[model samples]
Target: MSSFVTPKKWLTVPLEDVILRIVGGGTPSKSKPEYYQGEIPWMSVKDMNKHVLQDTVDHISQAAVDNSSTNVIPAEIPIIATRMGLGKIVIADFDSAINQDLKALFLPTEVHRDYFVYWYRSVAQKIERMGTGTTVKGIRLEVLKGLEFALPPLAEQRVIADKLDTLLAQVENTKARLEHISQILKRFRQSVLAAAVSGRLTEGWRSGDNPERNFKNLGEAGVEVKTGPFGSALHKSDYVNGGIPVINPMHISEGTIKPSESMTISHQKYTSLEAWHLRKGDVVVGRRGEMGRASVVESDEPQLCGTGSMILRVGEDALPKYLEIILRSPTAVSYFNSDSVGSTMVNLNQKIIKNFEVYFPSLSEQTEIVRRIDQLFAHADRTEQQVNNALAHVNNLTQSILAKAFRGELTEQWRKDNPALISEENSAEALLERIKAERAAAKPVKKTRKKAPS
Candidate 1:
């Protein structure tokens, strides 16, 4: 125990001492066609994301629960995900039935539910790490029953919970505002790209400059478009340890080239596929998944276009960077989707890519547009970084608050203000005895089910 928590008033006890019951739930039989689509909310790991669950993705009939191992838990119970999600906890807003992955906790009247929920969150990460399994790691019933935690007097617990609620609400509000700003920034970036590709971005500069405003097809501009090697020309067996990197659609993200995690081809294979070699100015576009996803090859390293991709080598008439920006624009992306082939998975061929039209300007004007876009984008990046840093600090602050809270530091002043809660009537030990007595007295009640008329 930390120096902050004086053991005289704070009693360290096993979870089972304060917990009235721990109920393990089960799933209804999936083979029973009438088992589902009922009024009872059936919760799974996915529905446990929120702090409280008002409804679930699926529901089951009461007959289903009667036929299977599943049981319905009452409202206000805190359900902890024991298996798949591992430590995800949520309180039941309404009566709910859970799958095998969840275990609901029934806390004694002595322990405050909100207080325990916040405390559990602080140790959730540690509990998750202790789990062991080959596929889905989970905590056993013994582990949960044996877990120990320090409990403050009931009044102090309520005060601590109320304080945290006020503080965390402010933090959540700020985070939501930052998230909204991020969404606006995304729309701003798309607007900039849309204007740039439509010849409207440089309308002011065009008044004094003699720029080509005509829209022309890519093939008419002397650009060479080629697809990657297919059929027997390239095989998975040809890949070796390391010779040349293959640029795939996965390797291109956010308009930049990234290192490939896939296999590299041999030097002989590289020589055989010399036509697919990528150059510094070449713009590579995904020819299959996510049509119109393109990236500018800024690296001088030797690389070849991998399968499911296309390469565009621009001549003196056009700038490769400018062409890539056009390809990434909303208009070109829509065109690519419309012209794509294949039923299950739409793909682009060399012909469709070669005939795509784009609004062109003089080389100098293109350079200016690129320069302006870079300037605005850099500012946006800086703002985004600041937002991310602030959000990280907020996350760290939550953990810090929890640590201080569990250490009894949060209510130190409150403890001094309210001294009556330290007495035997309201003390944690007295409360434990009362809970035990209540359970002991309630056990002998016999339920008499009346028989039907004979």
Candidate 2:
């Protein structure tokens, strides 16, 4: 009742009562191999991810620091990623240089560093409003300082920070536990697939009454497997609005075809590339760069796969789905790896695949094997999906917690206890005005770009 509070509850304080300093940073000459290889630690927005940054892939030296616009961040200063990471913030524990894509805001004595971090993130809506542009978005320095928000007292701020830290830590621990479960699920997937191809999966399906059908070496099974249509004619511009999907290596990950992100061609183009065009159940393998990774066509979409991928339609004796399981198995991977030898880049044509000796059950038994494999895989996939879903939910919750902590709402009880020790503030008007005056009075310091090394 003394100042700024509701019966339900809220607290308010001026913002300028908090800020100590604001500084921008830049990178040293990356062209100078010398600047890049030195002992000093350097960070980029990409490297900025949750909590402590124990190590960096790149470093620069004192000499590079002296030459570059990038400043050496003192300990405990908050480094905010303005782009790339786009909202990631971390406290610098050691001296470091950041690229031009970040901002360093040093907290003042009255404001808790953790509290300021929470507040900056809490006012995300306001930050987003100030952040404008088409190519990339960010708030202007002047505009950010001028930004206003209701704040709790110093004591309340610390409480909010403490609660946030505790809750966020719990979220992180939960995610790590989920990831561990996820890894176990992945291993289960590999084990199931491996067992399927090794003949162990169909052990009971083998009828003593049924005759075993032997698989012809892959080449004899069909013809020599050939590379995909090798023409630069398929330029990016040639891609049509819709037609046949053009599958790339990225589409085939972990030996599975992902049709979601697909490029298309005209039906006319599809006819011309008929030899390379994928069919209903063709087994495709990636060669050239990736070499022997494989997948099977599951989509009804008519399309030509890329040069990085090779397509082979096995004979009628070969079951498409059955072949897909084998090709994805570790045994098939090792077989491909062995045949496509000699160069760092493993290459295999129809000749090598045709020569691969594969074991097959009779048609009736083959169908049974596939059915059993699919049933077990369905169970494994369901478990993997659960872990993935849990990870996503945890990630969203963590971010939301961070968002709330920054806003004074996170510690409403603490604010009530502290009760407007200071008052007459609804927004950060004082902070805004102070920043403007400081910028106006400050003299510009020139920093020159360093020459590249020869």
Best by lDDT: 1
Question: What tens-digit string does per-residue lDDT give for candidate 2 at 1-454?
Answer: 2322322333343443345667788888868888887888787876776556766667988888889898878777888766545556777678777778788876655456787776666655456655767878866666766655444445555677889889988988999999998788777767776776656766666746643445556666553365777767467776776567788766787657775343777788778777787877887777655643577787777768776777777677667777777677777778888877556677766666777776665567668877887787788778878889999999899768865665445665555565554233422344334445654555366899999998
Per-residue alpha-carbon lDDT of model 1 for 290-320, expressed as tens digits? 8657988988888889887889988897888
Model 2: number of backbone collisions:
6
**Overall local distance difference test of candidate 1:** 0.82
Q: Estimate each model's TM-score.
A: 0.90, 0.80
How far residue 392's Cα lies from its native spot in candidate 2, in Å, is 3.1
> RMSD of candidate 2 to the true fold?
7.1
Backbone clashes in model 1: 0
Q: How does model 2 fare in lDDT? A: 0.68
Q: Which pairs clash inside model 1?
A: none
Worst 10 residues of 2 by lDDT: 1-10
Off by over 4 Å in 1: 1-8, 235-243, 439-454
Candidate 1 has its poorest 10 consecutive residues by lDDT at 1-10
